[model samples]
Target: MTEPASARRITGAGIVLVFVYGVMALAATGRSFVQIVREFDDAPLAYGLSAAAAVVYILATLALMFSRSRAWYRIAWIAVIFELVGVLVVGTLSIVLPELFQHPTVWSLYGSGYVWIPLVLPFCGIWWLRTHRPAAVPELAAAAR
Candidate 1:
């Protein structure tokens, strides 16, 4: 008489959002890897921030794409919020202190390198999640019990 824990399904717009997240995750990870390996000394803060951004993107992608659980849903929200804050703070700092960053991070100037996707993605994520909520996985339901 109750909806199964695994009843969640990503439909319509949800699939597009997941694809975008996947792209962002790959882009950030690749960018950060290059920066860390090739020019870490040139811009430690930028490189470090890029790496951190990549990790957040990866987590977000995984949380949304793979899991259909209440916990992962919460994680998606947290990741999206953190990403928004990171972009805002880093974007401001990059503009205000141009000299502070020898190199730009993924969030620098609100993702200028990627056509502002970083700036826009979080808002989209929040909206999409709100509109297309997923059901919990069976494992998660059992754990929650």
Candidate 2:
């Protein structure tokens, strides 16, 4: 017998993570949507990247919320890694090539406009996932013992 995967997905800490990711997804999606629709031509690169970040956030949130299988776990890792890469790349570019971004993306300067949460969240997520992985089945549990 085995503990179900879904049960492990919503531990106390997991709930907090889910809530934060949900907020980030909504905030990024809404901000980028408004900026892109209202003034895309003003900062195409910034708005486009912001929109892309929003999508990534949404996917990451979903993956974490429903991480009931190995596939979902892997997807969550991929999304978070992508997010980390995006923030680092964009943060560096914002500093090195300021002219390329007329305005700020969600990842601008390592999420300076968002108080650097974007930079910190992915690391937290990966840590949580690694520490709180689902338990193995009876056979594997015995094998380890």
Candidate 3:
């Protein structure tokens, strides 16, 4: 017999997505930590935004990694969507009000500091999650009925 839908969902491209998210999580965490520890005084808002981005990245990574679960799938969507909004808002603000961002954030300039991965990753994640969503269980359906 073939693997279950949940198992198949996390193979191949799914694995790649998870790996990329994991890397992004680590990178964001490290960058934010350094900024907060060393120079938060110089640009509190920018550094705080970086820290918030790092938290979002970490949440997304964990949620994606465990997305076989329905709850985790929901969390993944929330985290990824939040990340996208954060990127767009911060990127636009950084450009329109440059003085507000004396320092670059992970999301500043549409993730220019990270070569735009932060901007693009969420779209990819949404696509991946949509395509890989777990098939509804008959038990749940029957219970609901």
Candidate 4:
């Protein structure tokens, strides 16, 4: 039997998210690597934070891309939440304590380098997941049957 439209829609949204996150992952990784290579000793704390954020973005992208289970969805949600918190905290700190961050991270300056998309993407992701709850899939399939 064919999959229901709702299932397809949800999966499609997930695919779109995968693409977006993939781009973010690349940006974060590249920027972090560049900073670390250029001057790791200058601001080790900020550089390390950037690297950690890159890792999280990469993992979240992969999870969303290959996830077939609800557990994976949950993991993605958690990762996205962490990403949001990291951006907010780091952004605020960068503003409030400019001296602390001699270097920038993906979350630095409220993701200003990325046009604040990083700050907003997680909220979008959470909303998409909530609206596309997997529970709707069984209902859709049953109706189709």
User: Which candidate achieves the best lDDT against the true structure?
Assistant: 3
- Residue-wise lDDT of candidate 1 within 1-145, one digit each (tens)? 8866455467667788888989999999999999999989999999999999999999998888754667788899899999999999999998999897759899999899889999999999899778766655678789999
| lDDT by candidate, in order shown | 0.87, 0.88, 0.91, 0.83
Which candidate leads in TM-score? 3
Model 2 over residues 1-145: C-alpha lDDT tens digits? 8978765567888888888888889999999999989999999999999999999899999999877666787888899999999999999999999998769899999999998999999998898889776556678779988
Please provide, for model 4 over 22-50, each residue's C-alpha lDDT reduced to its tens digit, 9 standing for 90 to 100. Answer: 89999999988999999999999899888
**Collision pairs in model 2:** none
Lowest summed-lDDT stretch of 10 residues in model 2?
132-141
Pitting candidate 2 against candidate 4, the one with the higher TM-score is 2
Query: What's each prediction's TM-score?
Result: 0.85, 0.86, 0.92, 0.83
Angstrom error at residue 2, model 4: 7.2
Cα RMSD for predicted model 2: 3.5
Q: Tell me the alpha-carbon RMSD of every candidate.
A: 4.2, 3.5, 2.1, 4.4
lDDT digits (tens) for residues 1-145 of candidate 3: 9878756658887788888888888888899899999999999999999889989988998998888789999999999999999999999999999999989999999999899999999999999998888668789989998
If both were scored by TM-score, which would come out higher, candidate 1 or candidate 2? Answer: 2
User: By TM-score, how accurate is candidate 1?
Assistant: 0.85
Off by over 4 Å in 1: 1-8, 135-145
* Ten residues in sequence with the least summed lDDT for candidate 1: 3-12
Minimal lDDT window, size 10, model 4: 131-140
Q: How close to the true structure is residue 88 of candidate 1, measured as C-alpha lDDT?
A: 93
